[model samples]
Target chain A: MDVVKTPQQAAVTVEPPPGEPVPAIELVKIAKTFSSRRGIVTAVDAIDLVIGEGEFFSLLGPSGCGKTTTLRMIGGFEEPTEGQILLYGDDVVGVPPNHRDVNMVFQSYALFPHMSVFENVAFGLRRKAVSKAETKARVGDMLDLVQLDGKSDRRPRELSGGQQQRVALARALVNRPRALLLDEPLAALDLKLRQAMQLELKRIQREVGITFVFVTHDQNEALTMSDRLVVMNAGRIEQLGSPREVYEHPRTRFVAGFIGTSNLITGRVRAMDGSTALLEAAADECLVVPEAASAGAGVGRDLDVTVRPEKIVISEDRPGSGRCAIRGRVAEVVYLGTSTQYAVATAGGTELSVFVQNASDADDIAGRGADVWLSWRPDHSLALVTTQPAPAESRSDLSGGNQ
Target chain B: MSRSRLGARLTPYLLVLPGWLWLVVFFVVPTFVMLSVSTQTGDIVSGFQQTFHWRTYVDGWNQYHTQFIRSIVYGLITTLLCLVIAYPVAYWIAFRGGAHKSSLLFLILLPFFVSFVIRTQSWNFILSDNGMLLSALKNWGLVSQDFHILATAPAVIGGLTYNFLPFMVLPIYVGLERLDPALLEAAADLYGSKTATFRKVVLPLSMPGVFAGVLLTFVPAAADYVNAAILGGARTTMIGNVIQTEYFTNLDYPKASALSFILMAALLLGVFAYARVLGTEDVLDVAAR
Candidate 1:
């Protein structure tokens, strides 16, 4: 097994080999629309994606972002309204799910209630007309893989939620299809179980060496499990990259805020000097950020600057020198075990969040109403060209674009 | 404190008091009275005396054994026919009826708006030798002029099936309604063919409803005399018809009571055997889940 690395270390692209094998699955300009009482609603827009063999790919987005629909289209449970879906280079436009060389671990776990654990695991093999002895042996091996060897006779209801999830995984994997599609298979487990299953799923994927297409609304799960993931919004791909690449250098404001907690401050470009651009914000306050971050924005153009909370340092004494600095009064202090968070009200009437690690040095703790200085490197603050207002209620707003 | 505790303990029984009283008055007491009457020995005018006349039961069974068997056969056939006809209709309503589910169910029950006797009689007209159906068949050269469906086993069974169809449909609809559609998709994803998926997932999941429907249709159809009286000939006489004749037409209460007891006992035994054969415990367990 490869050593588990931080997101930055794991950011390398998974380029295909010199002579690439046919992609396990290819979705070309696929679109899906549903006509309901509310009229036609496009669930998935023109989406083109190629999943390499043995790649752990993820579709990460909020609900209604078409991630699950895209997964379903690949699984053959749904037909695309336009474009083509190819499985191993074969166009599978009208193929039924049963005829496709793929299996899905449904969110509901959908285990056959009438069948025992052994029978459930053997279901796909039996459908394929595998020999009885081979089916039994394969089922036993799968049960052992999922750590469910001895409880074969037990029914689904008799098992716990985590066990049922493993059974679902076993059932899907026993078929040994070219790829496995999982639709939030761990969503039902508790927090600790979900975390455990995330690592377990990655381990199982590595062991089996089959392409895995996972769909989830949870950015953390996507970051932790996917080799490369696509962030989608409003039926379109917002950004696609490795977790570190998408997180560290998000190309769009939506991608920036969706992937993690970001502080977006809108301002107009006041001056430019090489890679540094000076922006005049509200209340005569001027901030400097990397000009390369908002390269297309000339002078007098409005742009948004995003800085992560952890990147901001809060100090009671004014810092001597920094590329970017803001004076604020601490409005709230939140102690979160490993870290302490402060919501600082800036002089420009904007609140900037700062996260400080809870080390043994208690000198950095800022109390409510304390005057403080928030500072970070100019490179740490990314300037984005202001785009259309982001959808409200995504919890992405930093200061006053829209509520 | 003790009195209050006692009141709390008695609350459940108090709440069920009305239903218990109704059952005892309408069902239990009448059943015991009939049992006593079945063992009585006397003419109707002599004020029948309870002499423990076991011979009455033997005599009733011996005299109408063929009719008893015939009633069971008709019940079996009616139940089977109701299942075959109701399953697909119920499945469609449960799965595909969508926004019109309630209205489709109402249509299934539309026949109940008219009287059951009228409905059975309406079938008598439809299946008569010179009825519209026979005439149409004759014009289409599908049958001879003398070919008739009325006054036969099929006619009586058909009437029973039509009358008890709602009983079969409603339970199965309830069962199928409770199914999670994802199970079928999962089966298909697992490489199960359409027919195999239906047989493995859809059929087994809907068994509880089928069982309930069968019980509802079979028990009542077995003891029903109206359909046989209206749509059957003398050769198609069931045990229910003989019991009715013994009491109302022949004025023989003892034999009638004995026949009724036999029918009830036989039905109870049949239901017990059916439940045993199908592993009712497993069905109940799955349905409960």
Candidate 2:
């Protein structure tokens, strides 16, 4: 009942007699291409993913990133143009949606407008020819679970958005499918309601113990609700890990930039000393990053040294230490409720963003044009080898020698 | 300022004035004149007078009651036949027409480009004793030489069905077009079989179009005179034929007016009953108000 565990931990503990239980849903190089007048559009590239049973997994990305396509393929709404999809051990390649043991909570909710809430919940049971009494009992139980017990006789349109959303959820979960697919089900709700529904969905998923594959373009929603998330870009997954891992230690420059704000300083590896690498970031400034961060790149390879704004400490006075330090002038200061963000232009012409927490007693707000020093630990800076050649605009703005 | 406020309040009425005026001149006046004529005693040669002869209604009904029953029965059969044929056509065009939906809808409307009387007359040649259909049937030994269809009730009913089929198709197509594809997918995902989904989801949602189609086809079919005149024998004479005869051949204006009024009343009563049976009174109520 403790829903706070990581997906891996939950997967491990929930399946009792297991060294490695079969995944609830597995995709093997599944690809989908739509043919239209404009020509071929690949919505989902060949991608392999394994979602563990009872894990709250998320496919997170910006729009047009194929997160929804991946979820629909799992739900049997869209057939993969190539490769295989396995549901628990069975390959459900040619199976229709009705035959698949999966139910989806669509973004629009897609509740039957003509049916009352109770009838909508009981539709699946009636389709299976369940007895009338059993169908009624199950529908009542589901309505109670979704906290819509007394409102079962009301039509979908007569209910509020949140109530209708719960009805959709109840209608899908009442059948207890093997896996539940959610395609931005909370996107239509207001922020406060969406946040509440996020917890409610998590609680219900825990109670039912069904593997949930949730697709969303909202980064915050993905980070908050998912135990493990795959950040996708252009029909392919950029990175897959626990939310904390993907946030704190992003594997790619795209992941670093997309998950949250990161100041990407372009550089090339200059030297390596044990666990540290010297990155020539600008004309006169050399940044020391963890050598392990650039482990896959050679000495001369172009790399991006990424650091979160919060990791960089900024102060008017120089912090005299062995930390990597750059002196800059505060170009702009943005006052956020919990933190102050400073846009600092370094003497080397590279702009560094730094966030300072606004603790009650810490009232030293750096004003614009204030000369300051930005410093961070070498281990905090991550060096990711650039996969594509740096674009000319980005390369010319680096202000450093090619070496 | 008060004058301008009055103008602002009266703007909507002013905008609707032309339409109301047109209805009053063309429809309301004609209907009122017809109502007065229905209650009058008259001969076409002299003139109709406002005699308030209510007995004409009872006398007309007493004489031509069989024709009235035949017209109602033909209307019901034609509407049912149109529904049976049009539902599949509308479903196909709406769901499966894909890139050709507009062209398919154009094809449904193609018959309207021809004159209605001309098309009904064409069925005469097709269903005649020596026509292609009967000739082929005779050649195949499917029918005897004496077998004929041109002047039968079936031919008249078939003509009614054919003439009003597009009326049934367009409204049903509109209903099916407005249906969200996601709803059908949701039904399938919820374990509904194709037939069950059609029966429970598609049919219920398309009721508005069916109701509209039925009204469009039935009302006109019941009052149509040309089909009964051309395709029906004397035994199959409908109320429309009797009304036509009283007006033209017999020159009994009072009896024709009475029959016309009775037809209108009967149709209105039928429509009301139909609405009640289909539980579509809400749609009608919204439309009426």
Candidate 3:
């Protein structure tokens, strides 16, 4: 899919067929800015997103990357400086959160401390004036779903962190809103508990079939849970695609670096070999970027590319022909049980990371300071754009950031 | 290492020595002295003797039962008034005061810089008939020349409310101030209206503060005679005024001590009942934490 979708494309997505499924939430040209002591800071540059019904979507980004702000705008907790947030089909910018058909799970869990788990879960239903019997049955069912049925009478403080998180989930899901917005719900959990809750949350989402808009800075969390995820940076989306697509085919330098470890290389197109552009880097190093990724590059234009560590194979001898190969010496080696990571330093002062699966309990092919060859398929080389050609300094900064 | 362990064991007691000594010398001794005086029979001309006159309590109650009830009634009214007046002020300072929250809190405490009696005396001056405030109000037709506030029950209650207002504001402010803003957002996200959020989440969470403020303000306001002396007359005489009169004017030390003990007992009983009615142990646990 094309990254940075155009306004025309976004407009085309607004109206679905009469019988077709509609988007659960549509953020159209949403922009938020805040004036602080420093100055006017743009939190979320105008962006468009259409999250489908029952889709587990994530806005993944680092801190201060406008992911939480976007979720807040969708939940109606915050007013956008510009743009319209549509819940299902109705515009809900001026509507208060109480009037919106959405619920949020705060990062802090935010369960009412003074209330029992039953009362906390029953809060939304009570607000909606749900019949007492129905509210009890529904809250009871939700507590069961989250496996907190027996602890309904207990206060939030009495529960463990993971249990409290389940209570928070039950509280939001009890209302059965059109969409559930979760802001780093499991960020507070330990590694084991967090992984467990991730699957648990996914299972609950599937069982309830509610659209889940999860905001998280953890790339692994987003990749593992989201049906589709948007990678945001500096107030705009760098890319949006499935875990495989975003991981294997990141579209920008920021996305490539932010997702996971990637070997960044900047070079000028020395020549075009049919569908591949031969790139020449510092110290006469040669690499080939595919024509599909570096389409704008001619014989002399500059290009940037990234290759994932797992894609590059490290060998004791030079790799065979038909693959891009570079001679380097092993700089460092880290033995992970499943896979071993090797940092290969080329003569051009480029340190390319290569992760080779430890297929057997044998010694690694190359040890530290051993001469080795790193090679990857040309198709795996992803050309990156700083921002669709914005400015000179930023382009320089992009190259500066690659190393 | 053994010596260090011994020092560590004694550290807590050593640290507590000053406070323990202060309480014993000031509070414990005076309480024992008052207890003894309460059971003695006395006359101003012929000095008091330890005759175990426990009947003085019954006589004191019989003579001043009206004042005791009035004092409690005034205390309840003043507590309710303070809660009503302080909750919003505390809420405003907590949620809306923004950058000026500390300054606003400082403003609430500013009047406390003046002596308590001086403040009550100022209220006396302001509420006095044909005084500066009454004359000004009369000139503006806000009140008639026949209007009066001094030497009335309401003036005394009003004085009590104003004097103890900060005691109510500070604790409630602390409770509301410590409230997590995310909880409010969560409440809103759960589809709660503004009023419902305030009623359910904000009010219940701040109950600890209200309970604390009540404890802090009610006892002192109940035992206060300055407001009664300055802003009240015959009908408004509380147990505090009666105790003062028996202690200083009537020269009946036995009756004064006995009445003081009765007032303390009544206030204690009232507090225990209030705590039982307003708070369960669970709520108290949260409030205490």
Candidate 4:
């Protein structure tokens, strides 16, 4: 019920299932550790996640962030080092992939090259001891659903990459699995095809009304397709929320910078209001940020602030109408068709980037080396908790006196 | 064009030409000569004339017809049996053997290092009346002491199977080695059980290996007479024994030559038939790769 009706829609309204709890998939404090020559690398930290039935969920992160590891654990290909994976209230931690009611479309689209398209799609049904007539009919319907009806006789190698991708989808979906796991399914396609497949995948998930756990490193792909995304970093979850909720209200500096481009301003808290904080930046500039009402932090404490580029406006003179203003020198101005990017240097000798849209040919106001005043609405700047460094000495050693 | 580029292309051929020429002169020429001599009939003292009778082939067939046909039958049975036994072992060694594979494969090939004749002769000691195998069978009450296994049809067939087992294993191992493990995993993910996965995916993908192993076991088994000479008496006198008898005992070179060429022709037809079914280039080149 939380599914988006249109591909272009950005809003998601979740409606709970009818009465009973939808025990879709629950991982109870899952931990996975791998031993290698390097050391015991914790591929997945002890974390819990509950993916509801019929939810299009995504595990989004950068490469080597353990997002894929989480997906694999749920697919029954891997067992957690400590915890249990429950699908529909049954423990599936030790279950084999074939025994689980889940199927994964591999990153390589690992379609069986030996079988015809029809056989590949009908594989699971036959495993369940479906009659020959029923298997044939179901396979035919699945091929038709994937827009590959008549091409069932063709071998996997005979199909193009996109068609092969569709065949893989059909092969995994034909069994009516309780959940479909996609591991970078569209990462193998070119840009145009990836975009097209993203929409097609979302549409297919909608039509089938099945829980789809999609894994990807591409932020845009996650944002465009997921009903909810769990952003992972270094084997831990950085944030988990709806795409718009996470994008607009990132609780951490990592989440803010990762979901899109943003500037991190480290500072010490100078003063605090009920829902706002005034801070003195590391570069000696003062920044005012709106704080979350729940985080009750006292004054003179270290904090981090996040400001999106598009939210900040650059003008030659002080815009007296704005809530907050900072003086800076325009370092560079690069025009990209619809918008312009200005890299500016603040009076405190810190560089800041600002993105200004060309709403009506306002290019003359923004130019290279022009002194300007940057301002943003008071509510736009976010005051987040400054993640603790290992130690000041560790930071100094890592920097090697570069500062 | 460029000297290095041309040299690169020619280097492979230059390195390969000596071997190619060796095969053509030693193997190709001898096969043609045998084919020619197969169609002739004469006594050794008279020397083989170019009679081109071709009826000598028919006469050779009539003289050793039962044995000649039985060899083919034994070859087919051995090949089928080898395929059934070797396929799973080869698949396990290739896909599931993991890091211990190299050592296991070496062990399989270790028996061949001692020489085929030695291995075939050793079967006699194992299958003889007073041998450990027959004695153990007697102790176990599986067979009577008067029931002789040596110098029988099954003994010759069993010896052939043992002699050429590595040949059957190596080709199948090669085929299975080239198989991609991901393909099987994909089949399993698509809901195939262990058996269905092997039947639908693993078998078809490894056909090149199966064909190679079959050809390897069949051709040599059909041409060999050593097993019959050692373990089989007059009961299992195959074509090779018939040829040996004609050439040495009866002093009939023309008849022996005719029999040799007929056996060679039968082998060629068998290979061609195998190629037609499994694809010639696929089996050979896959194993080679």
Q: Against the true two-chain complex, what DockQ does each candidate achieve?
A: 0.92, 0.62, 0.85, 0.51
Cα lDDT computed for each candidate against the true fold: 0.87, 0.84, 0.87, 0.79
Docking class of 2: medium
What is the Cα-based lDDT of residue B138 in candidate 4? 92
Candidate 4 segments whose C-alpha is farther than 4 A from its true place: A1-23, A35-40, A131-137, A281-285, A292-298, A317-337, A340-353, A358-360, A364-374, A386-403, B1-20, B40-46, B126-149, B177-179, B244-251, B274-289
lDDT of 3 by residue, A39-111 (tens): 4667777899999999999999988778888998888877899998877766777777877778899999999
Cα lDDT tens digits for candidate 2, A1-403? 1112223222322232466788888898998877655556667778899899999999998787788888888888888999788777667776777777789898889887778899999988888777899889989998998899899989787899999999999998988888999989999999999999999989998898998999998888888889899998767788899999999888888888888888887767787777677776544444788864444755776667788999998876766667777778999988888998889998767788888899989977588898877889877888764455544533332222110
Preferred candidate (lDDT higher): 2 or 3: 3
- Scored against the true structure, residue B131 in model 2 reaches a CA lDDT of 86
Model 2 ranges off by over 4 Å: A1-18, A281-286, A291-295, A347-351, A385-403, B132-142, B281-289
Cα displacement (Å) at residue A26, model 2: 1.4
Candidates 2 and 3 compared by TM-score, better number = 3
Backbone collision tally, model 3: 0
Off by over 4 Å in 1: A1-18, A281-286, A291-295, A385-403, B2-6, B129-147
What docking tier does model 3 reach?
high
Best by TM-score: 3
Which whole-number lDDT from 0 to 100 does residue B284 have in model 4? 52
- Summarize candidate 1's per-residue lDDT along A1-403 as a digit string, tens digits: 1112233223433344677787888888999876655456677778999898999999998888889989998888888899888777767777788877888999999999999999999999988888899999999999999999899999999999999999999999998988999998988999999999999999999999989999998999999999999998877788889998888777778888888887877777787887677887544234787764444666787777888899998876766655477788999998889998899998767788788888887665678999877888878878664445645542232221100
TM-score of chain A of 1: 0.89
Q: B3-46 in candidate 1: lDDT tens per residue?
A: 99999999999999999999999999999999999999889786
What's each prediction's clash count?
0, 0, 0, 0
**Per-residue lDDT of model 4, residues A257-297, tens digit only:** 89887776666667787767777643333467776444445
Using DockQ as the yardstick, the better of models 1 and 3 is 1
